[model samples]
Target: MTTYKRMVLASRPKGVVSPQNFRLEEVQAPALKDGEVLIRNHYLSLDPYMRMRMEDVKSYAAPQAIGETMIGGTVGEVVESKNPKYAVGDKVQGMLGWSEMGVSDGVMLRKLDTTHVPLSAYLGSVGMPGMTAWYGLTQIMQPKEGETIVVSAASGAVGSVVGQLAKLRGCRAVGIAGGKEKCDYVVNELGFDACVDYKAGNLVDDLARATPNGIDAVFENVGGTIFDECVARMNPFGRIALCGLIAGYDGEPMALNNVRNILTMRLTMRGFIVSEHMDLWPQGLKELGTLVATGKLKFRESVAQGLESAPEAFIGMLKGKNFGKQLVKLV
Candidate 1:
């Protein structure tokens, strides 16, 4: 019998997740069933969306059940396989629950070609984050060249790509982040036209100065007070692609006092989860690959040491401590 360490959700969180909400447990690995593969996790992505899963509520994905191994997206190497399509030593990304060692029925695991990029990137740039940014910007917002665009949490995994993509398309990108370093990186390194420091306590004023011409498109990531400013600044026929709401992922729903702004600005807002667009992920990955291969796309990750560090990573992400993609290296 093979036993592996697994992190299980201990209880539902109140507002913010603490260490008490998770428990490290030992579980025996089940025998390989038909069309299944055994794998050891290499990297796991810690996303803000996982915060929403901790609570029992209505969401795009079901809430993590009590006592389960939690949930996450991970990259792994196959060690044993009953599936003909996959071989031992193949690296893959699986929408597997949280565990050091796991078995997949081959349903959620996607075989990745490491010859193109690093295997860890499958959980970051070219994977969910990249696809989410691509779909939200190209398909949802549909901004034209020379337009002014703004995205909140612009230094994050999805928002960073969203701003860069807008810049590459000839739009002026204004980013809102937490500090001066991240703001400068977005403007100078990621190529955004300007960046505002939300921690500076001048978001609305800074946004006004940055986008004097008004915002034509917004790729919304954090939704709280920023959502108010976005609605006010959006021009007529402006587009908004709702991504994540890390600001309001707790037990309470987001508090918004300005519903009249939507009608006044004539904003076209659409909310979507990345999982719903898996059909387009192939095309998204191919295009993103070309962009990355040509040095047009850049990625940053705040890597944690091991699987046990996932909880700390998750906590940091929720507190807006991460500047870019946050990942836990399991192996």
Candidate 2:
């Protein structure tokens, strides 16, 4: 029997997540029973939302159980299968957690066509992150052409896509990123109209300069003060797609001082979980896949090698240490 490495949640995080919260163990690969498929994961997605799952608290999804394999999105090749729907050597994507190999009964496993898009891209641009960007922008923050749209965490996986999609729709896309390098990339590389460097200690003035006409729509990822600043500059009847609030993910209090702007500006804010809207996945993924395939969309990745690197990589992602999409190369 072959052995595979897997990371399991060792404990619930009390504050900032530490390396001690995870335990890595080598386990034997199980035999594939009838209607089952065995996968060797190539890439593991480390996202911000995973931090919320590390705590034992009530939320949209259940907290990751201690002593279980850490929950994550994965893209890999099917090496063995008894299921008629899946063939050996098929590229597939699934919520297979942080493991070198996984067994699946095909409940939510999706076959991938990697001829145009790389297999790893399935975990980033054309996968859940891409769907998140699509749903939040098209479904919630429905901005029209010639409008100004601001995206917080603009250099991240979802935010990068949001800005790109906004531009494609003829909207003026402005990005809010942490540092100079990321801000430059958001503007020069991703084609965003302008990028505000929040770490430059002039967030309010910088954002104001970037959006001279005031923000007409917002794709908010970071909450707290960043959100308040955006709210303060929102145009009347502007829409906001409330995604992840990563600023408060470490149990920090998320106090918004601009709550009055929602009423004063008559802004429409909708908090959304992309997974809850499965009916729209086909439409969203189709458009994203086509855009990526034709080179109309662009993305970047920051990959950490090996399964053992998952814990540190995940921690780094939460701190905004990694650029673009953060992934663990399990192969």
Q: Candidate 2 regions off by >4 Å?
A: none
Tens-digit lDDT track of model 1 for 25-138: 988888999899999988888888888889898878789999998898999899899999899999999977678889998988899888868887777778899889999999
Give per-model TM-scores.
Answer: 0.97, 0.99
Instruction: Tell me, by TM-score, which candidate is best.
Output: 2
Model 2 agreement with the true structure over 226-293: per-residue lDDT tens digits: 89999999999999999989999999999879989999999999999999999999999999999999
* TM-score attained by model 1: 0.97
The C-alpha lDDT values of all candidates are: 0.87, 0.94
Q: Model 2: which residue pairs collide?
A: none
* Most lDDT-accurate candidate: 2
